[model samples]
Target chain A: MRFTSAQRLDDGVLEREFTLGEIPGTLWTPESAAPVPLILMAHNNGLPKADPRLVARARYIAARGYAVATIDAAGCGDRPPSAAAEQARADLRRAMRAGEPLDEIFESLVGPLVEGAVPEWRTTLDALLELPGIGGPVGYSGGWTALGIRLAVVEPRIAAAGFFAGGYVPRAQREEARQVTVPLLFLLQWDDEGNPRQRALDLFDAFGSKEKTLHANLGGHTGTPSFELEDGCRFLDRHLK
Target chain B: MRFTSAQRLDDGVLEREFTLGEIPGTLWTPESAAPVPLILMAHNNGLPKADPRLVARARYIAARGYAVATIDAAGCGDRPPSAAAEQARADLRRAMRAGEPLDEIFESLVGPLVEGAVPEWRTTLDALLELPGIGGPVGYSGGWTALGIRLAVVEPRIAAAGFFAGGYVPRAQREEARQVTVPLLFLLQWDDEGNPRQRALDLFDAFGSKEKTLHANLGGHTGTPSFELEDGCRFLDRHLK
Candidate 1:
């Protein structure tokens, strides 16, 4: 994973969009002379690193004094949506939502998606750490996909994570979670239209982190409530600070 | 994993529904004099070990001179559906079907499911091997869940494996597949309603097995065609015989 270029977004923040080979991503770091904590913010499934919500969150987190990075998910962001795959994914998700049984299709879509995303995340983390002042207390925040859950298990650099609603727990990775001791702030939307509530509960139940907390609010899958997001900031603060 | 009880089915197959502690499972073995190969058969999502289709497959495989075992999934069979969790899983799967973007939820579901399952399978395999004539070469057969994909990666005793299409490839588990050199016979239903074709393709692509074969049939997520089943049996015969 190599950084292609870095640009000064403004006086307070530096923004760099890079290609670790084919994978595209954007990194935002506070323009500080001293090293700061880094937050690897992952976009929700289907959303890109440049999505406004992510951009806003990155800015918000960066303003709070941290290096924030968001990468284009597989087939998202600067990358072209995989041909035929994007439509097939949409159709599969639609059928699943229509109360039809599409577990197989869901598995097919999600399994490889996670496989593709996790490696890129690790690579991005490796690259981020190499940059000056982009080190110390690394963390991750993402929605529904809980990609960080796997990261927490595999990436020792991840000291804390904030996982939001929208993802189900895979059976195999459930066991891996048992090895994750990272402090975690898990957010859940009560009426998440994209995920089941129990999956969150199950994942929370499976987490080996003695410091994990579940923050649930009354809403669908969307931008997390401010209070919950604050709770997350505090959680990351406790660990990353 | 412990044996609760053993019953002799009149059909020359000894049926034993045992508990590897809390996990419930049933093991069926041919009432033969010689030690035989064992086939770990898993039901598709939401189906129990006793599901007739699985039973029929188990019986057919047993009649081919092998012992067969099927365990109830986390919420399946005798395990009371995990209390309030089943509905959540249903909704999650629904949202995924609707294409609402629940990759994280899918990961949550599939990760834990595999985490919970891989151990159960290992335990079950251990117990099955303890029984008379249930030793020698071991194999696995299952549907979209493809629970044994991890077993293939982790379990060296697995001489060969037949993974039916419909399950997604977990991101964390993908690298594990590269370690699986087990002779593999991957079965795919051409138009599997539950899984996308690409998922199967990706998994097939990820597998490191030089001796792997893809047996695809044209149909929704239904029964495998006879010819494909026969081809799978032959594949098994080559490894397990």
Candidate 2:
């Protein structure tokens, strides 16, 4: 992990960002050495790496002794891609869906853009998981890329998944979601225009395991409140710790 | 306003939607009869009438003894029109921009679609202003319709305006914004694709009056948190009450 910037919150709280893999992210962790669980957060489509809600959530989770990282997916946040590169990335994503090995796909798809930082995520997670008291399970949150990370990487380390406004394309991606054995929690908006309610319901119904659950909130596609984050963390604790 | 559904949050907390004009909207008003300031909220392009943040905001304002209404602008919500009718409405808006009276434009350009319980908003506001204690002050909050409403009406009864994610044609609309003498608040997102930040900044800088203030948040074109609404309510309360 590489340091980007640091700041002290109004109430003497500390916030900082670390560059991990292709994604540069903000990390909020308590000062103590006690190893706590870690959460990797990916923001909604239009939100940036330092979105206030995501920052607040990191702070909240940090206060609870969990390390929280809000990462900007490729082509988002301070690191934006050129127009041609962005189209190429989208095309590469389409190619990967046509059945490519995870490592080869990562190399061909994300490697050129990320370069050296591509392997940093695995190293960082390995280090965190190896910490003395950090025995709790790992979880992922936010939209598309978060789902991509959860589905593509069959990480035995991930104990559960909390999806916020993440939609599975029925004919295309539903089968991938069926393979996830971990307890999956879906957070959806009742009237989200981007991903309609039925899409979420369909995913819930198709989940091969009965361990999955769905919670409907009143916000739109990008409306996940702090309370929901707390609930998600608690759910992760239940399954992983 | 006609009540549609109600959800009671903790004790004395109520969230409900009502059929107002041609749109279904959520109304958050104090339980008591005491007169308070009013805010008419206009949603973003991707949101429905019952977005959770909107409902939360209405409930929050109502809890604070203020009246707030979240309305679905024309051609949205339950009032979605046929393609031809939608084109007619757009033409009517264009005609109104050309200095035509609203009633005449409505008759010639958009009369076919007008029927049933759809209230003419301007007429409704005119009637509302005549009622005792209802003349307090009015304000509009929305993106696409913010400038449209400002341009369509000659002089609204509103004392202030808080626009979120607007400023789409800043150069062309400079003259229209100049006509608004009310203290204006513009909330813009840093990386909004829909409404470019540069355009919003240009529009803010071009405003003729010092009464205008600009706020930047870290969300998409949709919206940020309740700060805009809260500040808007405070602005309206100072002028209206």
Candidate 3:
């Protein structure tokens, strides 16, 4: 069936606003399926809600019969309250009051603008999980947004996570990788020249989970692999299925 | 000192070649210095000898009081022979017959047109190392080319290595990491979607030297920290000094 942003429950396609508490997101799912696995796809840093990468990924996974929800975290994507320096300062103040570190404060504030439409993302994920056909394992991809989802969602329904050039803040959170009982996959480049390689390794090493797998490619920092989607499919299939 | 092509070395601050053997590269050194430590730098794939990135890097390193050399590998950069399908096919055949990789074969066939440019990167390193007053650790950066240098250089003079998004290739020549006995510092990105995180980890883990360290940053692929050169200089100072 054709994939559109509107909600469609019968042909296994649905798009609607989901609310995680007060957080909102845009959800997409297969209408005809029942209790199928769910995937929480987060956008890359600074990507908009309608980013082609996120949209394409959602469509690809949905065609595979899995429910995919793309969320734009706070201040990101289509969320209102544009990312102005003044707004950022206010968000940072709130995070600081919460005892969160500087990076987390920055992440919570500017993350949305750098990720996607945030309100739609939170609303979408919540709505998708409540659907009859959507349940079971949850996976996350993209970068900063994925890390945000990990913080917001603690449901047992999340069975696995896949990071596509995304990671968590406060360094210590990465140390808690083992706590994420689900399988975790990290994709990176060797000749990136942009991103450092050591931190990714440290995170992998700190991951207490035995299901963690890492794959390296020859591409540079903006290079996408030829089989990234297929690889993601296989990983989700193995864990969520 | 001014940097110039091999043909203009006589008139410039430093004269250099892009590669000494089957590799492609550029060489630069202060015309006033009696002799200096030769620094070998590798470029990322698809980058030519004259790429602005390489030029900037070379110029920066040269200004830092080291003799800098940068090279483009085969199949890319300021050297492309015959750009014709039939000629390219013939060139490949000749290289294979000569027991060389395509890059080496192409370098040999197009030596005259490209001015004896080949993938003799290691040979150049050897020549540089042998130069008077060049005694000390050799430093390298870049992606695949850095790895290539690590594989080919057998000299004991290479006291340290600083890798920037350099580790990506699979283990080909029987435990490549075991050969690296010098201090190594690796810089990586936590959210790199391009390179495989595991391969970088494998390389870090394989480093038998006791002085290996890995550092991670929050940036995505190719994310250079606000002070990358400063950090690199610090790392080099700690080890190469």
Candidate 3 local lDDT, residue B49: 70
Name the best candidate (by DockQ). 3
Q: Judging by lDDT against the true structure, name the best candidate.
A: 1
Q: iRMS of each prediction in angstroms?
A: 21.9, 15.6, 8.6
Model number with the top TM-score: 1
Q: What is the TM-score of chain B in candidate 2?
A: 0.68
Give the per-residue lDDT of model 2 (tens digit) for B52-119.
76666667656766566665655556667557556656765676567554444444332332222124
For residues A61-115, what per-residue lDDT tens digits would candidate 2 score against the true structure? 6676666666665566777655755665566467657654333433344434433
Off by over 4 Å in 2: A8-13, A20-23, A31-33, A85-124, A127-136, A145-153, A168-172, A224-226, B1-241
> Least accurate stretch of 10 residues (summed lDDT) in model 3 chain B?
B110-119
Candidate 2 global CA lDDT score? 0.56
TM values, all candidates: 0.48, 0.41, 0.43
What would the DockQ be for model 2?
0.02
DockQ of each: 0.01, 0.02, 0.03
Error of 2 at B102 (Å): 55
lDDT-wise, the better of 1 and 3 is 1
What ranking of all candidate models by lDDT puts the best one first? 1, 3, 2
